[model samples]
Structures are given as C-alpha cells and as structure tokens.
Target: MRFKYSIPVVFVLALVIIEKENNIISKVSDKLVLKQPPMVLDSSSSLQLLLKPNQSVPSFHFHPRTSAPVFTLMKRRLEDYSSHQPRTQKPKQKHILLLATTRTGSSFVGEFFNQQGDNMFYLFEPLWHVEKMLTLEGGGTNASASAKAYRNVLQQLFLCDFSLLESFIDPPPVDHITSNLFRRWSSSSLCADSVCSPFVQGDFEKFHCKARKCGPLNLTLAAQSCRAKQHRAIKSVRVRQLDMLRPLAEDPRLDVKFIHLVRDPRAVLASRMVAFEKYKNWKEWGTRGGDVPLDDDEVMKLKGNCDNIRMSAQTGLRQPKWLRGRYLLVRYEDIARFPMRKAAEMYRFAGMPFTPQVKSWIARNTQVSPKEASGVYSLQRNSSEHVEKWRFSLPFKIAQVVQRVCRPTLKLFGYKVVNSEKMLTDRSISLIEDKVFNSL
Candidate 1:
C-alpha cells in the first residue's frame, strides 16, 4: 500500500514538472502542439514517471517570451528545416580506352570523343611517351615489361593523375612540369586554354593544331582539367593485348570501356607502305612484284601485326566477365563508310553525348579536298572513297602475300580473298563482306 502511494507521488511530481514546462510554453502562444514524451519506469525504485500523448501528431511545447503562433511558426520552420532532402552526388566518371594498331583510322575515331567539348578529356598516344622512354632505357623492347609499363601509365592517366606519366616524359618533367607531351597537338584537351594558351593567333588551322602555336603544357592544369571532365578517353596504338587491361577494367574507381578499331590487312599493308618512311623496304618488296618470303622479317612483321589485331579482336568479342558490356570492336572500313552513324555508336557505347559540334566536325573533315587528305598522318579524308582506294594502289602480288599470312584476320574481319591479280586490283568488285562488330 505504501509502495503504491509512493508511485502516485512520483507520477504527480513528474506531471507537475511537465505542467510547469507547459505553462512557460503557453505564455508564449496557444497554437503550439504539446507532445508528451515517453513514460519511463525506474529500475532502482517502484516509481513510474508517465507522459500521456495528447494526440497522434507530433506536438512541441516551446518556452516563455514566444507567442503560441510564434512558437508554432518556429516549430514548423524547425521541422521543415530538419526534413530537407539529402544532397545528390554526381555519377562516377566514365573512363574510355580507344585501342587500335597504327594507321587504323583511330585518329578519326578518337576525334569523335575528343570533340565532345569541355565535358570530355581525351589524350592521344600518351603511351608514346612511355614507349619512347622505356625503349631508351632498354625496357620497351621487352614486350611484357613494356605492356605493363603502358598499362600503369594508362591507369594513372584515366585517374587524372600525371605523376607516372611525368616519369616517362622526354627530358623528364621537373617538379611535375613538361612541355614535350607526344602528339600534344593531337588532343584538343591538351591544346585547350585550360592546359596551354596559344602563342599564335590561330593555334588551330583546319583540323591540325601546331605545337609551336601553343605554350608549354602545365601538368597541374592538365590534371585539373581532366578531373573537371565527366569522361576521360585515351587513344593508344602501343598496348597490344586486350587481356592486359583486365586490372584497369576491374578497378572499383573507374567505369572503363574499351573500343578496339581494326582495318583490313590489305588496306593496313597498303597504307603503311605509303605513310611510313620506314616501310621503304616494303615499298621495294611490293615494286619487285616477286614471291614474298614467309620467313623474311618484313613478311613476318606483316603476319605478326595482323595476327595481334586479330587476336585482340577475338578476345574483346569473347566479352569475359571483366570486359562485359565494355568491349566494342569497330572495323575502320565501316567507320569510313558511315562516319556519323559509327561515331554516334561509339559515343553511345562510352555513355557520352554525341553533340552537334562533333557531327559538324565529322561532316567537314570526312569530305575534304584531295590536298587536305594528303598528309601521311592526316585524319581528313574522303572516307567512303578511301576504303577501296587501297585496291587501286596495293600490288596484286603484295595483296596475295597479305592474304596468305593474314587469312584468319581477313576472314574474321569480313575481308574477301581474291583469286588472281585482276581480282586483287579490281575496285568494281566489293571485297568487304557485310559485318557488324559493334553492337549493344
């Protein structure tokens, strides 16, 4: 009976204290809702301090000196302020790798992403620096070591980190600074005012940006520009194997996409003969119009180049778990025939917007004068016409040799083999079979 009496006393005390708090609150204004706090039982004693809810809705009792209406308004404001939505974070940056062999229309395809304006950060042949430096150090000639080095540099570049690249820069960048980035003018991102200001009034003429026209490339500024971009893309003809990029693809920080570009072996051989001064021997070989030795260095080189491209294509087409929804194979012939359509497809694969600027650039560059398309390394061309132009220039004997050595590559990429010299040089007949290498 005494314990029950003590319980009532405790409840009364709790109620009195709550009532006093309410009185102070009432003096301010009458509109504020009075919410009862939870009733709690004391473990040490038989005392129960209880608070009964006035209604289901949340009610607050503010202090004295504030009117009920003022308190209510303040309470509403507090509630409204406290219930604000969480901030939305930006999506992970898209890291794109454009992989191809030399003279495969990679420059033209790379420009598709490079011309995406400020939102994109594109680098052209950044691996060239690595290969150059490593070769000087005698490590580049070793294929495995060189591929690993290229991968490391590429990984850093995609992260917008230039620290590793600085190590490979010619004359070596002092304190993360360098002016001699390989093909510096090739990447619009590097040429932008953000990275390097133009020394000359017209830094960019037609499609080419002359390096002399621009100031030294500040790596710090380049990095800042890279991070500011929503996407990053690097074009490389150096790294040979598609499987070599597994680590980069599986990286948690990057959303990576690999775009592999391939051209017909006959076309590649023909173009290499014209473009590279080093291919003079090949030119001599073709002009001789004799049987090409299968064991000869030049013939072996042709076989190796074609075989590597074929193998890489095969690997990408397999679409292993690490590379799923990330690998795309594009035939240079298909891109040449359909520039806008193929470019849009590539941009779509990389999850980038295909803007009108790129569209306009494609239109202007792809249908230039013969003079504009003359450079050995020129991206400007009459694309559709150039696809079959190889047939006219490439000797039938040389074409046969390419067919013999690169038969697997030809069949895989949908290039038809010719029976005789007449068939090899005939532009009237189509050699490219209808094929789709790039699909969602």
Candidate 2:
C-alpha cells in the first residue's frame, strides 16, 4: 500500500523548511509565526476564485510579489484614531475574525496569521466557560448555570492578556504576573453592557481584557489604542452562532470581519468515514443506530445531515447581506489542492498586507499538486478499497434505507443517489457477492 500524508506531503515539507528559515529553531521556546500577509494582486498566481452568494468581482488577480492589501477594509479604527493624536508617532490596530466551521483547517490558518510579530494577536478558541464545563457538568450548580458559566468564561477570556499567550508558548517568565483584579476592573469599565462588553463586550472579553495592562494591549479608547499589535484575530468554530455574531457586529469599537469555510459533502463524509473507521472501529461492533452493521439507512441519514447543514448555512448567509464579501465560503477541496492560491485569495479578502513571505509560504505549503489517491474508497491506491465502500460498508438493505431517508437533502450539496433498480444490477450484485465471498 502506498501510504503517505493525508494531505499533500510536499506542502508539509515546505512548511517545515519555511519554519526553519523563519528562525523557528526550537519548537517549544518559540511560537510559530502562523499568519501570512494579506492577499494582493499577483500576476504570477494561479487557481480560480469560487464566488460567494453576494461577492462581485470583474477579475481577481494573484500577484507573485506585490504589496497589496488582502481583504476589503470595512473600516480602520486605529489608523483613524492616530490621525486625532499628536503627529510624533502613528497608531494602528487591526481586528480580524475567522468565522469557520469545525474541521475546516482554522487552527492552521490562525497559526499562519499569528506570525505577524507583535502586530497581530491571534486568539485560539480559548472560551474558558466551555473549558470549565467538565467540572460544571458534575452537578446542578444553578438554574442558569450553563448560561452563567458561558457568560463568566467569556468575561474572563475577553479580559485576559493575549500578549501573555506568545510568552506562554515560549515562556521567558516562569509565572507571568498578571493582575486579575485589574482585568476585572478593566472589563467592567471598558464596556458597561454585559451583553455588548467583549467586542462591545461579551464572551470574547473573557480573553481580551487582560492584554490591556499585563501585556502590550493598552486599555485606551478605541481611538487611541495604538499598540499596532492591538489588532487581533479570533479563530473559533463556535462563532457560527448568529446570535453571538449580531452583538459583536453592533460594537462600534470593533472592525469585525468573518471568513466562512465550506467543503463538498461527499469529500467531508468520505474523510469522516475513514477517520471513524481508523479511530473508533465503528465497523466491528456496528454504529450508534444499530447493534448490527450499519445498513444503507444509516449512511444515507449521515449524508442528509451533512448536506442539510451546508445548505442551511448557504441559505442563512443570503439573508444577511451585510456579511457579503466579509463572509466568504472556502471549499476544503480547493484548500487541500491549491493551498497557495487559496491562501493568497484569503489574504486578499482579509485586507492584511501581503508580502514575499506569503509567496514563499504558499509555494511551500499549498497543496497545488494532484492527489495520488482520492482516499480509502479507491482501487489502485489500496486493496482496502472502500471507494464507494458506503455501498458495502453497511448492510445493503440498510444502506438503501439510509439513502431513502437522506435523499431529499443530499443532492443539494452534490451527492449522487443510486436508485433501487441500479443497486441490484450486475455490477452492484457482483461487488456485493465479491465482498460476501471474501468475508466467508
């Protein structure tokens, strides 16, 4: 069997090389500069842009090496604030939000963005309330315990200093002294309304407030916050909640942007199945809905749920036109296959300053080459060819049942359905007979 890295191996090597070149001499002591410069028009770049529901562009250009701002700027608060200050020095802050789904490579993207020196503070999914839930789950703490815990977590995270994070990853200070009282006070005074406190001020404040004094994040008015590194990016999957976003959008201080990512249901499902089989051995004892092997019924239902989520997201995006262009959908297939080009596109969309480093990074990390195997569901790649294994991985009748259950919603996201007549055809029968014969 020709086993290789699940994603492109070449891209991984490029990343390692780039890491070494960037003075990432030690893994533990240094935080990798994860973020790339924003996208600009590069004539040498390739890969086609897949349009979102409301984005309109005549022609998109990918530059080989040019200083182009990657994303559309809704507004630049710090730059404006600096204009009001004494001309002795300039002040600037950039706030970026990466609105993504689970398993959409957000952490990788955030890591790239975090490398912008002290200019950008990349916040991982540090929602403390959620983190503290393991303990909370043990008892009936309060009637609104979950909500209160979530709120408290948000408050703490928003107030925590992000600069300390870089140090945490590569600690110079054994126990970096931070004043939690100061943070709590800062959290209260900075934004009064608990609901609008983090950004206006809400959950994220649980993380962002402390950076004000403990680290470089100075707690000044939005107009005067000149720690150029004042700019921050939140990479969290939970931000998909529209209710959560609506409040943050209302905050006058924040220049919020959303980057939404998507993937083909077929590809996602295939990858997920492979992951499940490898990790859980779901096949050996059967799956959740059945004590016996999964029937077609279960597989079909899985497909339907996946498709429905994507379609609902698509539909939901249309109603909120304010999120147009700002809320971009990235296909996982494109990211895996043409990472450099895709990275360039994302840089451009985010309005960050793109540099040669980005080009070098893309050349190294983007998966621009063809894939040798589409994955486990293939013949030539491996003898364990479950390629379309969905056909035989489950009981034939159950598989059919799953297909029927999920059929209505499956095609919307690009899944093809095999009719009942075709299931009993010569090819299908032969494949099944072979599987059953092999088993005996």
The candidate scoring highest on TM-score is 1
The per-residue C-alpha lDDT of model 2 at residue 415 equals: 42
- Checking candidate 1 for backbone clashes, the offending pairs are 28-66, 28-67, 28-68, 29-67, 29-68, 30-68
- What value does the lDDT take at residue 395 in candidate 1? 84
* lDDT against true structure, model 1: 0.77
- In candidate 2 the C-alpha lDDT for residue 293 amounts to 40
Off by over 4 Å in 1: 1-89, 136-140, 197-213, 438-440
* Per-residue alpha-carbon lDDT of candidate 2 for residues 192-255, written as tens digits (9 for 90 to 100): 2221222332223223453342222232322122233455665655432433354454445555
Displacement of residue 200 (Cα, Å) in model 1 is 12
Best by lDDT: 1
Model 2: CA > 4 A from native: 1-92, 115-118, 128-230, 269-281, 285-308, 319-325, 367-440
C-alpha RMSD values across all candidates: 11.1, 24.1
